[model samples]
Target: MLLLICFYQDQTSLLSYTAAPSPHPSWPPAPGIKLCVFITRLTSRSFLTLSGHGYGVHCCCFSSCGSYLLSCSTDGSTMVWSSDTGEAAAVLQHPSRSALRVCAAAPDSSLLLAGACDGTVALWDFPSKTLRRCHPVSEASVVACCFSPCGQMFVTGCTYGDLKLWDVDMSLLYAQKDAHDLGVTCCSFAPLFQVDGCCVQLRLASCGQDNQLKIWIVSQREGTACTMKLLHTLTSQSAPILSCAFSSEGDLVVGGSVDKSVAIYDANLGTLLHILKQHDRYVTAVALSPTMPWIATGSMDRTVNVWRIGDGDSRTGRKLPGHSGLLLAYWSEVDVQTWLCEEGLEELVSIFKANNIGGAELSQLNKEAARELGIGLAESLGLRGRLLRKIKGLMAEQSGSEAPDEFLCPITRELMKDPVIAADGYSYERESIESWIRGKNKTSPMTNLPLQTSLLTPNRSLKMTITRWKSSQ
Candidate 1:
């Protein structure tokens, strides 16, 4: 979850404040021992590299039990490897497809979903060792996929900035929305909870190439389609966010950015909590340990830094040498937080109360104090201007600048400049459909059926209308 530690100049007296406990039964209880001593006793060297993917790895995740690691690569393959040995256990491919970019393992580890550069998602049933289905969900490449905790549904983020929700069978499209302008790079489904009677609450966090991180709440009405409503738009990052993950308890969001920094945010409050700039180059991927208060960050600098976290006494950066192309990182879950609560230094808890920082907003207030001591509050205040500009631009786009639904590309959700009628008797963006045919195969991106021809006929009437609309704007 979101672990808040308030560190003072002493460094030894690290105190932590805990948030409301998660209702998910799958989450393990927190650790019983203090973080500093517990982490110190663990092995210092924990880096392991899976060396089979021919191209750069893009995303990787640990299965719920931590027995296996699933990773997708630019090589167009998704491999299941033994987490302990780093040996490839199975390789998944459609023979015609490669360049798989993202993947997600079901919470029960019974199924796996792999997203490809061609925007197709492959659902695999591991027990039967069979390809269940290949779903063509978008024309632009699929960059991120996350399964719901209950395994009843999944969500995907596409390169064209579309976010879609699909049923467990990958048959029904429950909902769809345009989440970002340029492209949606990453998305994850937070653990669901029951709110009022018969009503469930679901939150989705997504980061995009547009340099925005958004939280959406998904709801459904009887006999109506599922809908996703934007809850918060977090835009404090000065660079594009490439990777994002929700804490096992769904209380925190950790993201890696192109600006050579890793940002940790409070999921409930949508506040940027900490920015760790340990890497020399762009931070491409980030993962939180399932069992401990640790965060693993993979960077373009060819280094994997395992950061030891504390309630109030976080350790300095520690870089570990590993894969030359470290694209993804993931950790298994455990109850480090509960352990600390039971056996941590009681004196530090009293210290936290004395400082008036023991309740909600403890993380935000403490992080701000830390920034005031380390850097100046000026930098933190400066982030607000950037965030405000992004929000204002978003508001303007949402109010009256929205294009007509027909003028938008079905795949990208953005305006379609070059509209063309495909063989499936549907109009699509020329570049989007052509890329799907050439990259994913000759199948229809919208129908996933064999097309009569790859050629696209220009939709002149729609194009003219789009042009006129843009001129009016």
Candidate 2:
């Protein structure tokens, strides 16, 4: 027989268990009263415990800047907490007077949304703490909600197994009926997107009571036409999946299941990477840190587990401290050699050095360039494939640094093709600033002061200047 004991303290919890002898007369009783005792001490990494909610908390999310935390509860209200301190900044009552089931903050931190049990969805201006819109989105209760990476649109999942996409004005743009078998439990949008001319492609993941996780490819064209298609369906978990999240880079997906297991998968390949079984009860919530290689999971057993992704080793097989923060566009021949060694292509280091392939030349290398370099240089197809993938990733990062700060939107941080001047006397991308204003923010995004007006004027001069800059490049 085994006996377990637990002790709770102000900051940590202590657990102890003991194993006693079997109670059988004929059982081999070797030695006198053999007993084994094990003592385990579990410490909490959490520094604060938010306790303002009167009922159970159904969902919680952090702001993009990590300054605020929003939690929805069954007490008919949503509470916003200061992430640095344990202070309840504000409490927002649900307009439906029903329990709030889920909440989501915009990627730009300009808007807040809360879904109620009565099928009501409320949008609030995050900066001004003012209600913007409250509408009934579905016949059944809304259980899941998330904002797109651009902050211009959001998706809501209901208990009726329906998924609806809405713009910032609460206008329904698209809807899919019976997305899941029973009901949609949770959904998340990837943090990155792909641009194909005038269309933007996004990846969305949703899990439900059907014991499955589905990934969908959502595309938005130049006009109002939008389309969605099923990309991948994952059935790694035996039980129903309760929660799902995407990594910062959108390369990995994690799901928590009612079977008390957490499964991590490759978002692109749709393959399972790892399964973690630590919680004794149903795992209800999962989140991946945007700045660190850590995952946090919450369970119905009232325990939260934090797991690190790697074993303290560098992700690229080896660490190169000298080239830690250096950009790929400025790497020298020696730096390229060091990177080759870090990526386990040390055998090709001599060849690359002989060719004098620096960062600038390496970033311009493609399949044709690789073939032109020589069949003997990159003879192995496997080696050439890995080198090209790494080079492509590096080139993408380099492109991000090529854009000038003046031509980039302050909110989205991307190069602006259509610049507009807001009432705050600052220029921003037309779409980005329009979304911020539509979110009901009366304050300026840069100065945080009340805006003179809500009107925006096209900045033709800035737009022409950006066009010239692009042409020169």
Candidate 3:
């Protein structure tokens, strides 16, 4: 058995167990035990259920130091609590007694930003424990707020899909055009990183009901006005992406969706890295642990799941050996699949035996569901090829239906529509392989050897074969 252990802020232990000698079907086995990729092994995971909020929690943020946690809820109150002791540190009240829809703490933890239903953004002075300033951001309800790393300014997203920049003194700086077609649900500032002695790169990430994550790059000088530019536009297959966050280092991004999955990405490369399908309801909020290798996600189901960041290449679809029992349990029950869409894992698991679903008879259905769900999750996260092969193995019984290895792109596990041969004499999709060569990487993804040239030779033969195969299907 492989034993995976996790330690949280309060030294709570979460344990999971899996049998070893298993390898993800697509990946070759490395010596020793492997990490279980799915959110199974529920016995080993733990989370703190903060209860002071009388209603649903809209947001949860950890301080820069990760010593405290600030949670804002629809209960018209925002509370600061000790992450270690789970003790309430301070409670900030909204003047309108409206639900605090969003909240953020400055990097220094000296100030707090809370957005309420009354269309006002309140600034709270930390040490003084007093209302510092109350600024009306819009006539519509303010739904999202984030503090820049330096804490000089912050940004707010409203129900009207407007994004407004505000100064620490409650002055309006700049407002972007309607960032999303629909309501903006969440926004986060990338941790400010010093670019040089004189300037810093300030980036912001926001997501909304319109199914888009916009990365805004801010160009700022020491004393001059800052200019903002749209860096990248990430569109999701899931119609409404509810929450998004940047890693403490600002190099990674995570977003939660209404489809009950969390997507992780390489922020700089704009590559989808992993799709976490653990949640059973709309993920309402996501927060990264500044000090620990974990990502916390809160959902409409009223449960928080903290995922451990395993030291593995998330892009690779490495997983344990497949088992038919788990496969059937996942696929056979139409009710379980429905519950996976409508309820939490506990509810899904509880109804397993009661449904009278079991055995190898349901393997085909499970395989089909796995394929559809995996593809949908991957596409929703803008990770087209990232997860196609990892879950592909779940269709163990349908071995003959698997695509020929030569038809697959080496960089992305998905089948190639336009195959190409690089100077290294290896085949890959035209786009995937070219992206690797054109981007920061100059070496071949398959061989890791330096490419003599970035030129790619089209493989018309492989394209014909893929076309013929598709026609046969």
Candidate 4:
């Protein structure tokens, strides 16, 4: 059976589905498997079902920005759907017409890869929806694939117990034959890369039918030659692992197994951190939210469970107070009015309410926007001045101060709203670094040396810490 699960950045909605065989004759029938995807909004308690795959969907993944959802199926096609509208965006057919077992989208959403049962992998350009190339990477069925954080390379695993690394051009970089005693099931790369002088280090986790989970260190020196070495081998679970994923900051790794348990591990020490046993059947899929302390797992019993990772008690889940836990971008109109009242700007609440100003609009309000909105003229000059200062104070509260130095972005020197780790092993504000690179600067902001890659991985752990600090204040 096929199962998939995904979560929104705000924890507002969840995407999950189970598959059952359909009677349609458009394609050959696969016994006892399902053929549909479902998107569920937790707030509204609504469901949107996507039904295009002719057979069981083996895997599904959301794009980097969570705008699009991609799924691969035994029907020999990879389908893309708009996350907002639930409409099919494109249908990518496998060149060999073989059943696709897994699919992954690149970190930058520039390319997509789908692996087939015949060991053929089809690479498609994301923007144009056109096939770029198809290469046979293994002699056995290609069951697992994932792109590296740098977006310059990817790894693929097959039923032959082999793991191979390749560049974006599809050229093999390294191969580990017999990486697992049995077939490989899933693999994931850590979101951050460590830069040591001219060498870059990446951590990868892979699990297989041998009932073992292994971690490897893949090193690339001067962006040229590469080496792979096993660092840790974990056999905490009693059954074969079916899925695995790394947390956003690479601090933890999670795996789901046929034993109906989800295991979380400390990525650095490779020690078992938690074993969650809520599923009644084999756990088939697992995903860790990049922006929140939430874990989602899909099981063969046709259920998906979400678990929260806590600081004091990892086993206990707690809720944050007021607007402390919610992202400012997702604040509602009522939330904004409440904030205004708390800030002693209750006099202007009517005006803000009339303009339908929410958290997002509040964030963009400035002197010009305020004047355009008639706030500058309608209110007394002194009141306007207080309002402006309060807004600035809000920005400062969200950015830096009393916050840990590590939580501040290196470039902006402010508390980061969207933090990302660069190649130099430092986290920075996403907009600042993106603008820096967009201006044709290739040197590392912290090291003053040449950057190995332009890719940036989300610093989810740091962001969560900042959020907690804000809540405590």
Clashes of each: 22, 0, 3, 4
Candidate 3: stretches off by over 4 Å:
1-51, 301-473
Clashes (candidate 1): 22
Quick one: ranking by TM-score, best first? Answer: 4, 1, 2, 3
Residue-level error in angstroms, candidate 4, position 26: 41
Query: Which candidate do you rate higher for TM-score, 1 or 4?
Result: 4
Model 4: per-residue Cα lDDT over 1-473, one tens digit each: 11233322112212233222222222111212222246653323456777786545677887876778898875679999987777999999987667787999999999999988778899999989999999989988898999999999999999889999999999999999999887899999999999899998999999998989999999999847789999999887767888888888998899888777777888889887666655656677787766556666766555566566765232333222345333344467888898889888898899889999987898888888878767788546667788889877765544322445477665544568999998888899998788766754466655445778999999899889889988987
Q: Is candidate 2 or candidate 4 better by TM-score?
A: 4
Return the top candidate by lDDT: 4
lDDT of 2 by residue, 222-316 (tens): 98567889988988776778899899899999988877677788999997667665566566677665655656665545455656576634331
Could you tell me which 10 consecutive residues in candidate 3 have the lowest summed lDDT? 9-18
Structure candidate 3, residue pairs in collision: 15-44, 24-319, 237-380
Q: Which ten residues in a row have the lowest lDDT in candidate 1?
A: 324-333
- For lDDT, candidate 1 versus 2, the one ahead is 2
TM-score, predicted candidate 4 vs. hidden true structure: 0.60
Model 4 alpha-carbon drift over 4 Å, by segment? 1-36, 43-45, 311-473
Provide TM-scores for the models. 0.58, 0.57, 0.55, 0.60
Q: Write candidate 1's Cα lDDT for 1-473 as tens digits.
A: 22211111112222111111213332222322222201121123424434675434556666776676676765567878775555788989844454576888898889989987677899999756479888788888888889877777889888788899988787655545568877888888876544555455688888987778888887755456677888888875656788787787778888777666677778889876666655665556666655555666655454456565544232333322122112112110112122114443232344344454422322233344535433225644544333334334423322223355478665444478899999999899888677667754566654445789887899999999999888887
C-alpha lDDT of all candidate models, in order: 0.62, 0.71, 0.63, 0.75
Q: Give stretches of model 1 more than 4 Å off.
A: 1-49, 221-224, 308-473
